[model samples]
Target: MNTAINSRIPVALTIAGSDSGGGAGIQADLRTFAFHCVHGTSAITCVTAQNTLGVRRVDAMPMEAVVAQIQAVVEDIGVQAAKTGMLLNQEIIFAVAQQVEALQINNLVVDPVMVSRTGAQLIDDDAVKTLCHTLIPKAVIITPNRYEAQILSGLQINSLEDMQAAAEIIHKTLRTKAVLVKGGGMQGDLRGVDIWFDGDKLEVLTTKQVETKNTHGTGCTLSAAIAANLAKGKDLWQAVQQAKEYVTTALTYALDIGEGQGPVGHFFPLWGLGTGDWELGKKQGSREQGAG
Candidate 1:
């Protein structure tokens, strides 16, 4: 590795859960940050035993410990931007929000991790209020998948119009500054689209969805990648565009890593490119980088 290009490592923080299987959560966030050449730090709020199949169990981290981690990072190394995932309870949500407000952090991307792709409940039922009232206002941008967006906004989204309507409402009501509604669950033949509502403008972003099982951690990776780009000073839309490109490439090279579903080849870029390592698909998966 050449040290010449390694100037100041732009710092980004992820306040999310831990996935022992490494498909999603902090593990995936770290890999995505490294791919974009940003230094990553984390404040883990829950621990889980999971794989490509689904999350089997979750134990929320103690609020005190979570507080300690956030304090340590913001007070020491100082993050350029931050994002969050899977907050299990009300107390934890409030805990994270307080610290974020105190620090007045910028470029905060919130990935409301409510449910798993396998339909497992990752967030607690009782904490929805706390999440909206506290976390939403603190975030610079909120990235929610179709279901998660629906739940967070209390809107039934089945069409593009509905998604745009709900995104604007959520943005205004929550005062989140911006709401990015991801249409990965769009009906019938339409390419999956993600909409971003930044108070003034509504941008709908689309990418052809590949029919593959390697989509684990995509939401987390997208938000983290956006935060990483923002850490490097890209504006909101530019960050989202770059993040979308990264996910597209990652998904194009899906990894058959687990017994049940599978994870996207996080390091899939290095194989076809030759000089670098498709660190995940090559070192960790049977699939090749450009195989998709």
Candidate 2:
């Protein structure tokens, strides 16, 4: 084997919308990337006026602007891996798919942000169809929560078997290398389980669910962590497993900053475990959560 490598820092790109709330979308992606010690780049698709409560308004960037941002980032910076979240509409999705194809980006992670954990539709029907047709096939893996998986695979996910079936369908239909059907929205014991299928064996990755209302940008964080790990040369399964652990640890330090649902503590390493101050962090987190 030829062993030739340079000393360049790994870079991860995020193609997504801007969340003013700073809990989800591009903000969360960049934070997760930073936590992984990877360089993070971004191309904003839409700008949303949002908060912990809900989205107030959204202004999508023009197609040319979105494309230009991606082109600029890729031409000079050269992404090692990329993850996409919250492509606002059909046009944006099509544009992103075109850029990914044109640049021949191999390690692509697609987080299909079509629906919320509460079963609320976050994207339009046209965008969903475009994503299923164009973007997903180019991805190395697609991460879809239970709600999005149900919409994409046309299955009602009520159990682990249902999640496995949905992962199979998503893999076969979307032509992606792998599918991670997240079970966060599932009721009871299935809550923190996720089904992973790579057109071969299926693996159920499970974690103890942290009981917290401050799970605002969990999906974004997890997918971004995967992309960051991929950029750092981790294998697919290892990347996913490590990413899950990071998310769980972050949830263990979830912050209560806003009036509504708060965000997971992305800098837990600086404040909690890394500094040997988890007890103090937990106490502070509780006070902040109660204050909001």
Candidate 3:
């Protein structure tokens, strides 16, 4: 139990890149932590000039700087849970794996951000190889979207069985404790069904797919939410379930700020107008109780 003496706040660390648009990467991770009421720390791996449209330029951080940031946070603050995203190259991936191994960060979630929806490879082959050999093995759980899972497992996922097969291959090949093959990119009814495999048990987690284009930071948000829930002492399955719920709600109230794909509403509970009857009832109750 990582209980800070004075604060006792659960802490989650995100080792990822920075999205200048504040829609994905470290920005999304921090927003998710805040939503879960957890303390968030970050060690940025790269800096990206990106928006809802697309990534324009990406500058990978030096291995030394990335490692130093991780060490600085871990040595003092001490993370209860940690996650990795957007490791742009082999050097960063290798350095991060070494540090995670050295510090023995147990509750680790790996989000393999390798490819875009258009089937374009985002990182180099060497980086993917490094992630396969090093980073994935250290993760307690790995969250890979359909494309990433396909890349990792070398299995095309066209159906539920295919998704499960891919998850199994990823688990066996990468040696992670658990694997979630997200099905959001799938077409038709298969869209929101995510497949989870944890060696012994295979589970299908499902949610209603929101009919919105404002889903830019969803992957980062979901992984960070899982890490946050883990930091809060939830079991592995419970953390994934909670994270799924959180993401569903965020999608339901997704933002419409950008011209392209906008960000999910991370602060929806704080900002969104409640459902009509519920809001009215709450107001009435508050008035009766002489509050608000």
Candidate 4:
């Protein structure tokens, strides 16, 4: 890599876990960042043995290890924006929050991966608490699914109005700069809707709902895309808007590879056009010409 060219490229960091399934977590975040033309870096918080069926086991990295990775990346490469996902436990969450403050990471996107879209709590109560009190406040914006919004805002999200209220409550109570209440876990017409609040203005964002079960990395991809856009110098509102659009388009091309739920195509544009496919197609064409 040319040092001068590499230095000029926009860089984004993801402090998250590694999904061996290659669907979500660090994998999804890095792919999303690359799709947006941002150089992606990561500090893995945990490792998971999982597939599309579900996670079988999880092993969290020590708090010190997580911090060391963050320091290594931030001190040298210097990310323009960063995002956090699946910090596993309270220790790691607290440690990451400290690093964020110590490193002065201003353009931070928090994906609050405490609760799943299906209403299952992934992290323990203490971990969630730490994320709320320690990490979230330092974020430029937080992307919370419906269940996470309910946990953070102390409200039930049954309708669009409830999502709006939850976004506002999270912004005010959590002291974050902005809140995005994701509606992917919602039912019926509200499923793909989202509410945004920035302590100044509120907006209800709606996009064409792409019907697909392969939505494994939707949340991770969305947050990563936002960070990527931020790394590219877009403002908060623009970043969120573009990220949502990118996710929606990616969902339309969601990969259906696994036995269960698959992941959104982070590089949808390159679908069926990988180097291997290109070579194979070229060889086949040459064979057909010889036959002719």
| Ranked candidates (lDDT, high to low) | 2, 4, 3, 1
TM-score of each: 0.89, 0.93, 0.91, 0.92
**Where does candidate 3 have its weakest 10-residue lDDT segment?**
283-292
lDDT per prediction?
Answer: 0.81, 0.90, 0.88, 0.89
Give lDDT: candidate 3, residue 102: 90
Model 3 scores a TM of 0.91
lDDT of 3 by residue, 1-292 (tens): 2334237888899999999999889999999999898999999999999888888999989999999999888878888899998999999999999999898787999999898755788998989999999999999899988899999999988999999999999999899999999988888999878999999999999986677777888899999999999999999999999999999877776666756887877876664256465455444434532323
Give the better candidate number (2 or 3) by lDDT.
2
Give the winner by lDDT.
2
lDDT by residue for model 4 over 1-292, one digit each (tens)? 1112246789899999999999999999999999988999999999999999999999999999999999888887788999999999999999999999888887999999999888889999989889999999999999999999999999988999999999999999999999999999999999999999999999999998777788899999999999999999999999999999999877876767779998876876674564576444334333522211
Clashes of 4: 0
Clashing pairs in 4: none
**Winning model by TM-score:** 2
How well does candidate 1 match the true structure in TM-score terms?
0.89
**By TM-score, is 1 or 4 better?**
4
**Model 4 scores what on Cα lDDT?**
0.89
Per-residue C-alpha lDDT of model 1 across residues 1-292, encoded as one tens digit per residue: 0112234888888999999889888998999988988999899999998877766898989999999998888777788899998888999999998888887777889998876543456567778778888888888889888787778778888788889988988898889878888766566654458888998998888876666656777888889999999989899889998999888778777677768666665776557566555454444333433333
Runs in model 4 deviating more than 4 A are 1-6, 272-292
Tens-digit lDDT track of model 2 for 1-292: 0112244778889999999999999999999999998989999999999999989999999999999998887887788899999998999999999999988776899999899999999889999999999999999999999999999899998989999999999999999999999988888999979999998879999987688889999999999999999999999999999999999888878977878998888988787556658768877765644422
